[model samples]
Target chain A: MEDNQIKNNSNESQKASANYDVVIIGGGPAGSTAAIYAARSGLKTLVVDKGLTSGALGITSKIVNYPGIVEEISGAQLVEKMREQAKLFGAEYISDKVIGVDLQSETKSIFGNGGVYNSRFVIISTGSMGRGVRIQGEDRLLGHGVSYCATCDAAFYRNKDVVVAGNTDEAIEEALFLTKYANQVYFLSQTERLAAPQELVETLKNHPKVILYAGTKLKEIIGENRVEAVLAVQSDQHEVLLSVSGAFVYLQGGRPVTDFIQGQLEVSQSGCLIVDSSFQTSIPGVYAIGDVLCTHVKQVVVSAAEGAIAAMAIEKEINGRSRMMVDWSEKKQ
Target chain B: MNSVIHVNDDQFEEVVLKAELPVLVDFWAPWCGPCRMVAPLLDKIASEYSGKIIVAKVNTDENSQWAVNYRVQGIPTMLFISKGQVVKTQVGALSESGLKNLVNDFLAGKN
Candidate 1:
């Protein structure tokens, strides 16, 4: 009976409508920053999340580059501080995983674990997740040899021959890191030109232990029960065999996780949210921010700044509407 | 809390349609998964572009008439209106940059 009541209450919350000034999704840096700004601006804002801790920051061990921090700090600690600050400013935090959104209406409806929330403005700060490599025997040998994050698994392959497949800056960076511990690091790039930054390209070129292969695609990760080697095809149309003990396959490319609203909101070819300078989507009262956006850069600081900007914009909009209401009332009197 | 504007159909025309800046209307409904994904993104954009744009949301399930008038066939639909004219319509979840580019284009009179 109690379970039924809880379920019924959850359903009722979805149906019981109350208009909020601003509703923020995600509690990461971007979402937290937006909440702080919105609450400070005197907006009745509500922030919802699935208790996923910090976004990417949660996974990082040490963050040395963020501004204002004198000494190095853990990513998790920084995120905790940000959360504390946002909460202090009267930003309502709710533990809920959002399942749907209604952006076509005058009042936006957000459906989630906590039920439904109606708001004048909605902001999407949900970031992207890492993609998995699709290959036979890869899933079964995930823990044995196949890995994505080099930092997490680099120590396991110390003094062993390892292969890293990718062409982006991240891939190159990971390969360089692997070179620190591995006896030999095979950096495989599917394209002729290295897609990494110039500095990384120079470093990879100079490294004696690193064998940079251009126009080579990883065909399969071969191993009996553990990763032993990887088969590849060179640009010269020749099959090349590379022997290694461990393999790191980086699959950074994938469609955005916006399939939930198939026909609801405007999405780009890459599955990113399409917004204007004001961060407004095709639907009114709806906004988007951070890496989820279709932009050139997907840095953490940039996304946080976007969140702050969105909060301030919503505050001004609310103020403008109220002023108009007051003026009309005075005129009537 | 002070900045909040409780607007309904009765006052939408005056509070949103007749506003000075471009009005961004978010048409959303409950039980929408993508809408949930895009909610925080919208909030961030609203705060970022505060003085430049007007952001608001409409619940389609409650305000069925308004949703029908706009021909909203999906959840989380966003409409960009400028000077009382519907300038652009986005039909799916969008990223911050994606939405910002469109808003910038609208602000720059690019339509």
Candidate 2:
């Protein structure tokens, strides 16, 4: 027993040595499954995620089709169970929004809002919830007055009017952050109601600095060299132009979250990430799974299965083995 | 034999505006995701161009004087300056190839 204890201690130390073996982006079902398998096989694993509700599953009210569980549970609960399992198997989870990755080198670097993480393998499971298209003039004047990050550029608009666009909780949170610096914060929600908690929505409506514009769509950002104004359309087809110094857009769409890649990997014409049978992308060490793939079925079971396959494949590649060693049973007879 | 130089408001004039080589001034901040996305590309440019052009970074969070002077309202805003004048201004992140093309064009005296 003492010998076994010493061996386990040494193994833990080895896993915690210099760098991680695998870093999974997004803590959804697919990413968590990958982490669970990798960690169970004695590899260092780290999962970076925005939050439980950032993915499509996060917003799902009920999940009835997940295997083995007959009772209906919320999507977030199922994700939580997977996360718990992964953590139990020695996977580290951090709540950070991943913005970019450097996958060209041997040691891939993943940058997030909190810090930068490096690993030998990277798994792209940041499920599709990204903005598919850019608004008019948004591309041209991106750095002038049309900004995306409120924390980074809010100081640039001190005592100036700004418009925050979107309906997600992320948009509301950023708009609230901008209220501290900007004189007037006009929130334009494409939907009539904000997709956030009731308490947070009430706070936004009550904030004196915030002006709620529900059921309004942002048509164009009118600017030449810098952001001058924004033209928005209401549900009644009424046009309203608001003169602001900055336009902070936090809009989300039904697309893969690969824009931060910046043409680093191969992608399909429809913006889906291309991967081999083992879920490995064009880059040898990088892998993508889940809804990010156009050929993938939008089901939790399929994503989890893909995650398992990718983890096993990575294990084989790292160990220089011809075939993967499947873990069928864990009972020590 | 060169790396990206982090210029401050005090050293803006000597480092970026009055430099002998063409300057690619990157206005960035750490908290911004887009700024972080373009960082590696700038690092590559700084080493590849070396003495031909200078890749300078200005952290708007720390030094806002130069950012304000250039009327920068967004993170990762790049200013292509030549002969101590603003040649062009680009907002947001660009792909590796796009950035390389931009640098090449700037070196060949294209705005």
Over A273-312, each residue of candidate 2 has an lDDT whose tens digit, in order, gives 8898999999998999898777789999999998998888
lDDT of 1 at A32: 82
Computed on C-alphas against the true complex, the DockQ of each candidate is: 0.04, 0.48
The candidate maximizing lDDT is 2
Per model, kept true contacts as a fraction are: 0.08, 0.63
- iRMSD (1 decimal) for each model: 15.5, 10.0
Candidate number of the best DockQ: 2
lDDT of 1: 0.69
lDDT of 2: 0.84
In candidate 2, which residue ranges exceed 4 Å CA deviation? A1-18, A197-208, A267-272, A319-325, A328-333, B30-40
Residue lDDT tens for model 2, B41-67: 899999989989999999887798988
- Which 10 consecutive residues of model 1 chain A have the lowest summed lDDT? A321-330
Worst 10 residues of 2 chain A by lDDT: A1-10
